[model samples]
Each structure stands twice: as C-alpha cells, then as structure tokens.
Target: MLKFTLKRLGYMLVVLFIVVTITFFLVHSIPGDPITAMVQDLPEETRTVYLARYGFDQPLGVQYVRFIKACLCGNLGESLRYPGRKVIDIVRNYAPVSGVIGGLSLAIGFTIGILCGILAALNRNKWPDKLIMVIAILGTTIPTFVTAAVLQYLLTVTWPIFPTTGWGQAKHIVLPVLCMCVGPVATYARYMRSSVLDTVNQDYILTAEAKGVSQFRIVTRHIFRNSFLPCITMICSSIAGIFSGSFIIESIFAIPGLGKYFISAINDRDYSVVLGLNIIFTGIYILAMLLCDILMALTDPRIRYSNDR
Candidate 1:
C-alpha cells in the first residue's frame, strides 16, 4: 500500500505540472490583454504600472518561469482583477464559504440518497421502489442551475422560508446546499438501489438464506457492506465535481464563494485568479480520483493492487 500510494503521489505531481502549464499558457494566449482591458479607461501611466506590476512587461517565457517558481513557493501571485490582493489570500478566505456549503450538501445527499436506495431495493418492484426510482429520475434529468432557480422561487419567493441571497449566516447556506443536494441524492439512490439488488441475487446471499441466516443480519453484514463499496468512488467524484461546479450555484445565490470570484475573474481576464483557481480545482480532481482508487483497494478484499507496477 505504501508503494502504491507513493506511485500515485508521483503521478499527482506530474498531472499538477501539466495542468498548471496548460492553464497558464491558455490564459496568456487569450486575445485581450488583462492590463490593457482593465485599465483601458484609466490614465496612460496607470496602464504601464499595471503591466509592470503583473509582469506583463516581460516576455511570456520569463513570466511562465516566474509563475511556476511562485507556485512552488506556495505564492499564487497577485490577482489582476482585485488589485493589491494575493491569489493565495483570495483562495484562503473564500474557499471556506464554498467548503461549508459543499460539505453539508454532500453529507445530506449521501445519507438521504444511500438510505433511499437501500429502502427502494428492499422493496424491489413495489410501490416504494417505483416511487424512489421516479424521484431519482427527475433528480438525474434536471440540471442543477434549473433546480437552483426553481428552488429559489419556491423556497424564497413563494414560501419565504429562506432569504434569496447573502452569506455568513446559516440560513443563507440552506438554499444553496439544498439546491446542490438534488442531483447527488438522485444519483446515489439509483446507483445504490441497483447495487443492493445485485448483491441480493449473489450466490453468497442465497447460501446465507439457505443456511437459515436471518434476513436482517444477511443484509447488514453482507449486502450493505458490499453494496456501499461502490459509493466510495461516487462520493469522491462528487467532491471533485461539486467544488468546481459550486460557482454556478454561488453566483445564482450571491454567496461570494471562489466560484463566484472565478466567473468574474474569467470575464475580467484576471489571469492570476483564473490560473490559481484552475490549478486548485485540477489538483482536487486528481487527488480525489487517487483517493477513490486507494479506498476501493483497501475496502474491497477481492481487489489487489500490485506495487511492482
């Protein structure tokens, strides 16, 4: 396991380098110059100052080398959109807001989804099963943004159960968290239901039943344990996706998250913020997949990972 983990860590560094390099070059290659665009209406002297401040005055190769060095030293550079702010500072400050909402959403979604799936599977082909499936279908089919809008309208506009916007308070988190939950719950429920059903039909389950093992023990010991192994991947994948995608929900609700800033940075051609955020997300994505692979190997005895590879 140690060797396997070390190998994955090495791969993670390689992937991070590739992601950072690609994002840096792509951002620089964008048509408009951030300094020129941001300061187009300001004084001519201001433009030159801004250019020098962000190293736009230097050649692209030099800038890339500096950016890489800064990243290695844990400095993400200064933001081009919000002057006088470091990119790392922005991430440090804003990440927690998104983190709170995303974490809560995942916990709720996973619990509700997995339980519902188990329930649906236990009642296979019955009314409960059919009803859960329908809910899962709707949740899977509906886009998150649309769900956010509809939820905002119903919860805020019509019912007035929660406020439409703002962060820093628990009430503000409810709507965004709820909106994010819709898709995850649907996905987990459907997948879990299938896993449970498949586990029930396995030879071991039949043997346990034939041996006069109680239904409850059989399910709790064997079925659920095996069925839930798949969810490790699902939950980790959601972690990668939710952090990146939370920007849209944050934008709609005015939540002031990294995603909210990310959108604005893109529009303003804020190279530092964009590149920093992209690298952060890409790292998270790669790390999550690595965790998924490790968790699967550890939890499921049937699978073995060879360190020699």
Candidate 2:
C-alpha cells in the first residue's frame, strides 16, 4: 500500500508540473497584456516600471522558473488587477464560499439520489421506478444555468423569499446550492440504480433470499453495502467537478466564490489570479482522484494495492 501510494504521489507531481508549465505558457501567449489591463493610461515610464516590478521584463523561461519557485514557497504572486493582494489571499477568501455551497449540494444530491435509486431498483418496472427515472432524465438534460435562472425567477421574482443575488446570509446560498444539486443528483441516481441492479442479481443475493433472510435485512446488510462501493468513486470524482461547475451557478447568482472570481479574472486578463486558480483546480482534481483510489481499496478487501505483478 505504501509503495502504491508513493507511486501515485509521484504521478500527481508529474501531472501538476505539466499542468503548471502548459498553463503558464498558454496564458502568457494570450494576445492582451495584463499590465495594460491593470493600468489603463500607460505612460512609457510607468509601463517600464510595471514590467520590471512584475518581472515581465524577464524572459519567459526565467519567469516560469520564478513562478514555480514562488508557488512552491507558498507565494502565488500578487494579482495584477487587484494590486498588492496575493493570489493565495484571493483564493482563501473565496474557496470557503464555493466549498459551502458545493458541499451542501453534494450531500443533499447524493443522499436523495441514492435513496431514489434504491427505491427505483427495488420497484423496477413499476410506476415509482418510472417516475424517478423520468425526473432523473429531466435533471440530467437541463443545463445548470437554466435551472439557476428558473429557480431565481420562482424564488426571487415571483415569491421574493430569497435574495436575488450576492453571498453572506444563509438565504443567499439556497438557490445556488439547489441549482448545483440538480445535475449531480440525476447522475448519482442513474449510477446508483445501475449498481444496485447488478448487485441485486448476484448469486449471493439469491443465496440470502433462499435462506429466508428478511427483505429489509437483505437490502440493508447485503445489497446497499455492496452496491454503494461504486458510488464512492463517483462521489469523489464529482467533488472536484462540482467545485468547477459552480462557476456558472456562481456567475448567474452573483455568489462571491472562486468560480465568479475565476471568470472575472479571465475577462480582466489577470494572469496571476488565472494561473493560481487553474493550479488550485488541477491540484484538487488530482488529489480527489487519489483519495478515490484509497477509498476504493479500503472499502473493498478484494482490491489489493500491489507494486509488483
């Protein structure tokens, strides 16, 4: 297990390095200059000072090395648009907002989805199963932005219960979170239903039934436990995706999250913020996958971590 973990860690580092390198170069290659974006009426002297100050005067290779080293040292560099503020500070301010909404959405979505899936599987070919599947399909087909808009209209315009936009109060999070939950819930329901169906038909399930195990006990002790293992991987991978997906939701709802800032930074050509956020997103995704692997090994004893053979 240790060897397997170490190997995965090594792979993660390699991937991170590649991502950072590619992002840095690609961002630099963009047509607009960040310095100009930051300071509008560019005086020649001021431009020179700005270039030197931010090390834009240096070669691309030199800048890349410095950027990597500074990042390794926990200095994500100052934002071009928001001068004097570090990239890490911006992330720190916004990540929690995104996390709260994303986490809540995932918890609610997964719980609802799994429960519906279980019910659907148990009542296959019945009306209840058909209804759940229909809802799931709608949820999957609908775009999150459209969902957000509809919820905003219903909750904010017609009813005026929740705040229309902005972050802070608990009420503000409701719409965004609900909007976020739609797709994930649909996805989880489908996956969970498939897994449950496969597990239900297994020989062990038949054996439990033949031995006259109570229906509830067979489901709780045998079906749910075994079937839930696949959902764990889906949940883990979805964590990172949910975080990224919030960009649209956040934008639509005016939530002050990494997603909103990420979009804003790109439009403003804020290089530091863009690169820093990209790296953070990539790192989270890689770490989530690694966590998923660890969880898979832990949940299923049949999954052994072996470096050899």
Q: Against the true structure, what is every candidate's RMSD? A: 2.5, 2.4
CA displacement after TM-score superposition, residue 50 of candidate 2 (Å): 2.4
Model 2, range 180-207, lDDT digits (tens) per residue? 8888789888888999999999999999
Query: What Cα-based lDDT does every candidate model obtain?
Result: 0.86, 0.87
Screening candidate 2 with a backbone cut-off below 3 angstroms (N, C-alpha, C), the clashing residue pairs are none
Write down the TM-score for model 2.
0.90
Query: Which portions of model 1 show Cα errors greater than 4 Å?
Result: 37-49, 304-309
| Residue-wise C-alpha lDDT for candidate 1, range 135-213, written one tens digit per residue | 9999999888899999989998999999998988879989999988888899999999999999999999999999999
Per-model TM-score on C-alpha atoms: 0.89, 0.90
> In candidate 1, where is summed lDDT lowest over 10 consecutive residues?
300-309
lDDT at 67 for candidate 1? Answer: 90
Residue 169, candidate 1: C-alpha displacement in angstroms:
2.1
Q: In angstroms, give how far residue 111 of model 2 lies from its true place.
A: 1.3
Could you tell me the lDDT of residue 108 within candidate 1? 95
